[model samples]
Structures are given as C-alpha cells and as structure tokens.
Target chain A: EAEVAQSPRYKITEKSQAVAFWCDPISGHATLYWYRQILGQGPELLVQFQDESVVDDSQLPKDRFSAERLKGVDSTLKIQPAELGDSAMYLCASSLTGTGVSYEQYFGPGTRLTVT
Target chain B: TQLLEQSPQFLSIQEGENLTVYCNSSSVFSSLQWYRQEPGEGPVLLVTVVTGGEVKKLKRLTFQFGDARKDSSLHITAAQPGDTGLYLCARQGGSNYKLTFGKGTLLTVNP
Candidate 1:
C-alpha cells in the first residue's frame, strides 16, 4: 500500500534549540497536513497545504513555527527555540484531494519530539 | 472552535469481549471518520461515515452515525489483543480538510 513518508522518527532538542521535520505524501495526492499530538490526546492540525499553496494555518503558531511545500509534493515543518511544552508527536497526513468532502487522510509514521 | 467529546477515556477488556467507544459533539458535521493508532505511530483510518443514521460494518467491527450528524459510535465484537489501540474520531471542519479530533479512547484487550 502507498503510504505517506516522514523522516527523523524521533528527535530530542534543548529548550533554545531548533527542530525540523519532513514529510512526503503519497504520489498523486494534492492535499497534505501537519498535526501535533500531545500525550493522551488526539492530533491537532497545525497547517494544511493544497499543492504549493497554503489553504489554512489558523491553528499554527506563526511566530515560532513555520512550514513550506516548495514543489507542493513534499513539506517541512520547523520550530525555532523549541519549548518544553512543545514536546509531542508530529504527524503528517495526505489525501487525494481536500475539496468539498469525502477526503480520507492517510497518516505517516510520526516523528516524536522531546524537548527538555 | 469545533470539538468532539469522547466517552470513557480508557477501557480494558479480556479477550473475546465486546467494547464500544463513543464520540459526541454539539456541532454538526458533514462526515465523521474513525482512526486507530498504536504506540509511536500515526493514526490509521478505519472508517468514514456520512449521512444521518448510517451504519457500516467491517467484519467484527460496526460503526454508526447519529441521526443528527453530531455523534458516532464504534463497536467491536469478540475483540482480540490486536484490537488494543487508541481510537480517535474526527471530522473535517470549514470548507477544507482540516480535521478536528476528539481526545480518543485507549482500549487494552488483555489475553
């Protein structure tokens, strides 16, 4: 089965350090998403991308967090000066298309971040 | 903000037992999707329910959508150890596909 791909399955960084995660959606998928999952909680959307354009980033912390998909195929999410409260599982998901409805996301094996 | 409230945050059952998890909300949704996640992994899609009062069965598992489209339920019959995982319910809000998720229920099927 085709699946979304994520890099750096695990990460450990200090409070003042920076961290980055990458994701590659399945071929032909036009919609990609980045989410953060705290322990014992469900994943929350951080950003959404439609090809190379951003669709929604209302939940994203723009000040310290940033994401981009240059070619609209692969994406990267970065956090500057990671905080201890930022420790969580970063997940990436992709869908065929995020139009009206009927888009089911396929998630990748997430990257776990632990900030001390 | 759209939110989903899941009941029974945690559950444990012996093998061959039955279990059910619920997701509810005051807000209406166009569709609801269920997912299962194991330790250290992202959630995997289980089923998607659309329309009111819709029921779909997958082998020993059954899913139901509420008539108001604001709630959904998942039932597992004769659950085995493999059924142990965190089950999450979510729905896409707004015009895009940014899914709002419930806290999720962690199920442990003991042998």
Candidate 2:
C-alpha cells in the first residue's frame, strides 16, 4: 500500500532557531494536511492544502509558522525562531479527494520536534 | 469545527480483559473515525462510521456510532499487549472537510 512519507523522524533545535520538516503524500492525493500533536493531547490542524493551494490556515500561527505544497504533491512546514512550546509531533496526512465525509486520510510516520 | 470528548483518558488492563472508550460531541457529525497511534508514530485509521446506529467490527475490536450521531464507542474484546496505544476519535466537517480529533484514550494492556 502506498504511504505518506516524512523526513527527519526526530529533530532537536534551540529556541530562536529555524527548523523545517518535509512530507510527501501518497501519489494522486490532492488534499494534504499538517497537524501538531502535543504530548498526551490530540493533534491540531495547522494547515490544509488542496492541489498546491491553501484551503485553510486559520489555526496556523502565521507569525512564526508557514507551510507550502508548491507542486501539490509534497509539502514543507517551517518555523522560524522556534519556541519551547512549539515542541511536538508534526504529522502529515493525505486524502484522495479534498472533500466529502467518506474520504479517509492516511497519515505518515510523523516528525518529532523538540526545542530547547 | 466540532469538538470531540473522549472518556477514560487512561486505561490499564491485563491481557484478556475487555474495555470500552467513548467519544461524545455536542455537534452532530456527518461521519466519524477511530484511529490508533503507537508512541513516536502518527495515528493510523482504524474504522469510519458514517450512519447513525451503525456498527462495524474489525478483528477483535468493535465500533458503534450512536443513533443521534453525536457519540461513538469502541470496545476491545480480550485485549492483548499489542493493543497498547492511544485511541482517538475524529470527525470531519466544514467546507474543506477539515478533520478534528479528541484528546484520545491511552490504553495499556499488560501481558
């Protein structure tokens, strides 16, 4: 089965430094999502992209975080001047269709980020 | 967006024991999903319940969607050590079909 792929399974960074994580969704998937999972907490949506275009980012801290899916296949999430509270698991998910209740998302093995 | 609340935030049981976790919401869901996550890994989709009063079974696990579509439950029969993980309930809504998840129930089945 095809699976979403993420890079740098673990990362450690100093506060005020910059960090980036990458994700490649399963082929043919049009919708991609970025989520942050705090320890013992449910994952929260950071951004959603549809065919290289952003669909929703209201929950994203635009001042410090930015995500892009330039070609609509793979995506990158970046945080400049990372904060200690920013430490969490970064998950990437993809779905074949961008809409509907029937579509289920497939998740990648997330990147674990830690800020010191 | 809808908020999902999962009950029994943490559960520990011996192998062969059974347990149930619940998910509730004030807002109705068009559909709901259950996922399992091991430490250091992303959540993996287990089941999706679309209709109210729907029930689906996967191996030794059973999932039920309430008649009102505002709640769901997962029951594990004869749990095993392999069942140890985080159980999360999720729903998709909004114009973009954004997915929202509950805090999750952490289950540890001791051998």
Among residues 3 or more apart in sequence or in different chains, the pairs in candidate 2 whose N, CA or C atoms overlap within 3 Å are none
> What lDDT score is found at residue B19 in candidate 2?
95
**Per-residue lDDT tens digits of candidate 2, residues B10-105?**
999999999999999998988999999998888999999999999999999999999999999999999999999999999977788878899999
Model 1 over residues B1-111: C-alpha lDDT tens digits? 788999889999999999899999998898899999998889988998998999999999999999999899999999999999999999876778578899999999999
Error of 1 at A49 (Å): 0.8
| Model 1 TM-score (2 dp) | 0.96
Cα RMSD, model 1: 1.2
Residue B39 lDDT in candidate 1: 88
For A13-50, candidate 1 gives per-residue lDDT tens digits of 99989999999999999999999999989999999999
- What residue runs in model 1 are displaced by over 4 Å at the alpha carbon? A98-101
